[model samples]
Structure formats: C-alpha cells, structure tokens
Target: MKALVTGATGFIGSHLVEELVGQGYYVTCLVRGDSDLKWIENYPVKKILGDCLKHEILHKLTDEFDYVFHLAGLTKAANTNDFYSTNATGTENLIKNVIKYNKNVKRFVYISSLAVGGPSMDGVPLCPCSPPNPVSEYGRSKLQGEEAVIRQSDEIPVTIIRPPAVYGPRDRDFYMLFKMVKRGYLPYWGKSFYSFIYVEDLARGIANSVKTEKTIGKTYYLTDTETYSNEFLTDTIASELKCKYIKLRIPKSAIPFIANIIQKLTKTSIINSDKMTELKHTHWTCNCEDAVNDFSFKPEVTLREGIKWTANWYRLHKWL
Candidate 1:
C-alpha cells in the first residue's frame, strides 16, 4: 500500500504520515518548498515539494499513490479571499487533477474542521448530517472544500473527517493554555464548552477511514466522547501544573473593544477582534457517534492525560 499526504509537515499531517508508515504503507509526503520539515526529519518517506494548486506537480505525484489524504489548508487568515483561494479553490484543483490522472487512487481523505458548523446551533449535534452554518471565513472555506470533494465523489473514493480542537505534543494552538497553567494564571471567559481529540487519535481515525471500505462517501466527526467546559478545562490544566486557578470572566460586550486595542498594540494577528468574537460566542462540541460505529474510533486519551503529555512536551522542549 502507498499513500500521498498533503500538508505532511503540519501537526496533524506529520502524525498521519507517521501512522501510515507504521501501518506498513509506503508514504509520500506532498510539501511546499518553504514548509518546515523538522517534524518528519527522522521518518523515512518520499518528499515531493510543490504547491497543491499546481497541476504539473500534482499530476506527477497523484499518479503514483494509492491514496491521497488532503490535509493542506489555511486555518486563519487576514481576509476571506486568501481562505477561499487556498482552502476552497486549492481543494478543487487537487480533486480535478486526481480525477484526470489518478483514476485508480483508492481513497481521498479530506481533513475538515468543526468550525464549518459555526459556534453553536440550537438542538443540533453538529454531526455530518447537520447542515453547515459556517460563520467565519475559515469555516466557510472549509465547507467549500468539502463540497468540492463531495462533488467529485463519483470519480474518487472520498471521505471527510471533521476534527474538533485536536491537541497533543508539539501543537502550538493550545500552547498558550499550557503556558498559562505553568505560570499559575488562567482565564475562564464564558459558559463555553469545548471538545478535543488527541492528535494521535485523530490520525488513527484517518488511517482507519482509509482502510475501512464502509468509510467511502461518508463524513465523520472525530472527537473525544466527552466535552469540557471552560472551568473544568482550566482546573485540569492548573492541577497538572500544580498551580492555583484564578477564574476571571470578562463581559462579552467588552471583548471586541479590548481585542481591538490589544491587536493595535501588539501589531500581530495573535489576539484580534474576530478571534475574541469567536471565543466569546462559540461553544465547540460535536457528536462522534458515526465515527465510533463505523470505524471503532474511540479516543484513547482523556483530557487530563492529554494535557499532562502536552505540558511534559513543552517542558522537555523548553517551550513552557
């Protein structure tokens, strides 16, 4: 078996590549010229350096693989156009090229996000069956990408996996929480709840989807079974760090103004008004029942265990 993984240098993609190699599949990583290759430096795999949107590069690479895992995407950007171009249009280009050349490719797995469902939908479980009501440009673009794959379902074996807040060792998105816990300072914003899956668990789920014949033309939400509220998550992190928790709740109305000021002062896109808006209003929980039933996808790590592992990684690498 052979697999081609796009975004093979990213946090989730690198883990997927490792899992595929362990499963005895010859893995070929499709990476950009400037992408960081540090994560897979020790792994033995073929590396193809080119843009996913380019037909010449994808034409050559797509023909040689039995499976294509499309994980390359832009999560957050300054504008909507960039998001659409990279996530939506780039996905369309890849799928088109694959259909034209790689007719024998067994599977094409698309890694999407729970963001496509927006912050919350009343009485909806945010399942694959739920209609997408994306609020942000990131979410909208991802939905568009998924649509592109679904449209080409007749030509390829397509599967979509929407993972919620994946975290583990070397994940930078949740590093701030680890840092806050280490420093003994953490904040609880609102009545928000979140779901997370360990990166390894998500990778396993993706790998299984490729192997499982029933996964074709189906979409699955890969997440931990339980959801964690802000208070519970902060407390767990504090306990792991052996630190005291200080709970602070800022008014939702004031977040946008404060976020604007902070963005102006920092001159970086770290904490902007849009992110504050998302943080204030979003309750990111999902239903993973379909994934569980179809792929036997049960998350192996609990929140506490995963947090401890993440904190340890930070300490080991001097990132904390």
Candidate 2:
C-alpha cells in the first residue's frame, strides 16, 4: 500500500503518518517548505515539498499514491479571504489534479472540521443529513472545501471525516487548556457541550476509512461516544493534572472585549471577533453511529486517559 498525506507535519496528520507506516503502507508527506518537522522527524516517510494550490506540484504528487489524506488547511487567518483561498480553493486544486492523474487511488480522505457542520442543538449529535449552519468564516470556508471534494466524488473515490475538538500529545490548540489548568486558573465564558477525540483514535478512524467499502462518497463524524460540558472538561483536566484552579466564568457581554485584547497581544487571528461567535455556540456534538456501524471507527481513548497522557507529555517536554 502507498499513501500521500497533505499537512503531514500537523498534529493530526503526523499521527496519521505514523499509523499508516505501522500498518505497512509506504507513506509520502506533502508539506510546505518551512513546515516544522519536530513531530515527524524520525519517520521514514518521503517528503514532497510544495503548496497544495500549486497545480504542477499537485499534479506531480497525484501520480504516485494509492491513497490521499487531504489534511492541509488554514484554520485561522487575519482575513476571511485567506481562509477560502487556502482551505476551499486549495482543496479543489488537489482533488482536480488527483482525478486527472491518479485514477487507481483507493480513497481520498478529506480531513474536514466539525466547524463546517456547526453546533448541534441541546446536546444532540449532528448527523450526516443535518443542514450545515456554520458560525464562523473559518467554518464557512471548510464547508466550501467539503463541497469541492464532493464535486469530484463522481470521478474519484472520496471520503470526508469531520473531527471535533481533537486533543492529545503533540497538539498545540488544546495544549492551552492544560497550560491554563497548570497555571491554577480556568476561564469559562458560557455553557456549551462539545465532542472530542484523541488524535491517535482519529488517525485510526481515518486509516480504517480506506479499507471500508461503504465509506466512499460518504461523510462521517469521528468523535468519542460521550459529549462533555465546558465546565466538566475544565474540571477533568484540572484533576488529571493534579492541580487546583480558580474557575471564572466571564460575562458573555465582556467576551468580545477580552477577545480583542488577546488578539492584539498575540498578533494572531486565532482569538478574534469571528472566533468569539464559535465560542458562544451552545453545542458542538456530532453523531458517530454511521462510522461505528460501517468503518468500525470506535475511539478507544477516554477523556480522563487522554488528558492524563497529554499532561504527561507536557511535563516530559518541560512545557508545564
């Protein structure tokens, strides 16, 4: 077996690469020239240096793989156009080139975001048929990317996985939560329910999608069986880290002002007014019944176990 992975240097992609290699597949990573290789430095996978939007690079990469995991995407940007250009347009470019060059590829797994499908109401897991109601520009762009993949599905075998708030070792986003817990404080804005998956479990689910016949031309939400409230998640992490924290729930009206200050201080769009809308959503759970039924995609890691493992990694790396 052979595979081509975009965004192979990222948190989820790096784990997927390791999973594929362990499964006896020869993997090739499509990464940007400046991508940090700390996660995959020891892997034996071949690296193809190029941007996904570059037609020649995509064409060349499409010629030599039996499977493609399209994970490269822009999650945060100062402008909305940047999101669409990289996530939506870049996905279209990769799929088109694959159709023209790699007809024998077994599957093209587009690793999409749960943001594209938005929140579920009242802790209900959003199913495949649920109408998309994206809250942020980043969510909208991801939806466009899903559409792009769907457009080429008739000609190329494609599967889409919408993963929710994934966390594990080597993950940077949720690392902040562990850090906050270590700092003896956790801030909450509003009550919300979220679905989460350990990164390794998510990678295993993606790898299984390739071998499962029913997954082609379908979308699945790869999440754990349970949904957790924001407060419960905070408490769980604090317990896992063996730390005590002053839990503060800021007023909803003050979040926008706080987000502005953080955005300015970090000089990053990750914490902006656009992201504030997503933070205020009440539910982010998704249904994984279809995945369980067809792909055997059962996520084995529990929240407590996952958090404990992640916290240990932080400690080992001297990050906490």
Candidate 3:
C-alpha cells in the first residue's frame, strides 16, 4: 500500500506517519518549506516540499498513492482568515486534486477536531450525527474542511476522524499545564468536562480507518471513551509530577489579556482570545462508539499512564 500524508512533521501527523510505516505502507509526506523536520527526519518516507494552499504544488504529484491522509491545517493563526485559508481552502484544494488525479486512492482520511462539532448538549457526549456549532474560528475552519470531505463523498471514498484535545509526547499545548505543575503551581479553570485522546491511540485509530472497509463516507470520534473534568486533569498532572504547588484558578474573563501578553512575549498561540471562546464552554466531550464498533478501536493508555509518559519525555528532552 502507498500512503500520502500531509502535516507529517506535526505532533499527531508524525505519529500517524510512524504507524503507517509500521503497517508496511510506502509513505510519502507533503511538507512546507519551513516545516520542522526533526520529528520525521529519520523516518523511511519520502518528503515532498509543498504548501497545501498552492494548487500548482499539489498538482505536480502523480496519481499513484493508494491512501491520502489530509492532516494539514492551521490550529492557530494571526488572522481568522488564515485559519480558513489553510484549513478549509487547503482541504478543498487537496480533495479536488485527488478526484482529478488520484483515481486509485482507496481512502482520503481527514483528521478533524472535536471543536468542529462544538460542545456536547447538556454534557452529553456528542456523536457523529450531532449538529455542528463551531465556537471558534479554528473550529469553523476545521468544520469547513470536514464539509469538503462530506460534500465530495459521492465522488470519492473518504473518511473523517475527529479527535479531541490530544496529548502525549511532543505535545506543546497540554505542556503548559505540566510546566505549571513543575513550577509548583497547579492551575485549573473550572469543573468543565472535556475529552482527550493519547496521540498513540489516536494514531492507531486513524490507521484503522485507513484500512477498514466500513469507514467510507463516515465520520468517527476517536477518544478514549472518557470525559475528564478540569480538576481531574490538574490532579493527574500533579500526581505524575509529584509536586507541591499553589492552586491557581484562572478567571475566564482574564484570558484575553493573558492571551495578548503571552502572544506578545512568546509569539505563541497556546492561549488566544478565539481559543478562549471554546474554553469558556462547560463541556467538550465526545464518544467514540462508532469507532469502537466499526474498527474495534480501543485506547490502551489511561489518563494517568499517559501523563506519566508525557512528563518523562519532557524531562528527558529538558522541555519541562
């Protein structure tokens, strides 16, 4: 099998590439010129330098790959349109080319996000058939990407995988809290319920979707089938780090100011006003029943075990 993966250097995408290669698939990765190659540099995969927004670059590829994993998209941006430009329009560009050229492609898997479906209704874990109500620009852009895959479902075989706040090694978002724990501060927002998946488990589920015949034209959430509260998250990290810390409760109203200060100082989107829109919600959980029944998708890593591994990796790499 031949697989073409976009966003191959990212946290999740790199793991997906590793999984695909382990499955004996010949892999080709589409990457940007400025993308960091440290994660995927040693992989036995071909890398093609290209930007997804540029149709000319994507058009140059031959129609030979058996599978296409479209994981390329902007999670944070300087402007709202940038998210749409890279996530939505870029997805459409790829899907169009796949239909125009890759006639033999068996599956075009779009790795989406739980944000695309918004928070669950009344703390109920959302299913694939739930109506979408994206709360942030990033979520809206990913929803657009999902729509492109669904809109062209009849034209080609495609599957969508929506993952929640994924965490594990090489993850920077969740690392903020871990860092706080290491610094003798345990920060938490609220008692809000949210879902998360280990990167390795998510990668396995994604690979299963690529190989399964039952996933065509279907959307699935690939979580660990657990909804964790903010308190639980803090407690887990605190226990893993074995730290003593002050309890810090971040006020939702102050997030915008903190976002500005962080962006100005670090120029990172780890915290942003738009992302706060999603954070303000009380529930962001989803179930993975469809994935469980269809492909026997099972998440082996629990929250505690995953946290231990993540903290260990950060320590070994001097990132903590």
Please, what are the lDDT tens digits per residue for candidate 3 over residues 1-320? 98999999999999999999999999999999999999988989999989889988988567889899999988877678898998899999999888888866899999999999999768899999899989998999999999988888888899999999999999998988898877887645667898999999999899988667898989999888888998788788888888767777888777678777766676546677778778889999998999998989999999889999999999999998
Question: How well does model 2 score by local distance difference test?
Answer: 0.88
Q: Across residues 187-283, which tens digit of lDDT does each residue of candidate 2 receive?
A: 7876789999999999999999989789999999989889999888989888888889987879889888998788777755566777887888789
Q: How far is candidate 2 from the true structure (C-alpha RMSD, Å)?
A: 1.3
Local distance difference test, per candidate? 0.83, 0.88, 0.88
Candidate 2's C-alpha runs over 4 A off are: none
Indicate whether candidate 1 or candidate 2 has the larger lDDT: 2
Residue 31's lDDT within candidate 1 is 89
- Which window of 10 residues has the lowest lDDT sum in candidate 3? 261-270
Can you rank all candidates by TM-score, best first?
Answer: 2, 3, 1
Candidate 3 local lDDT, residue 107: 91
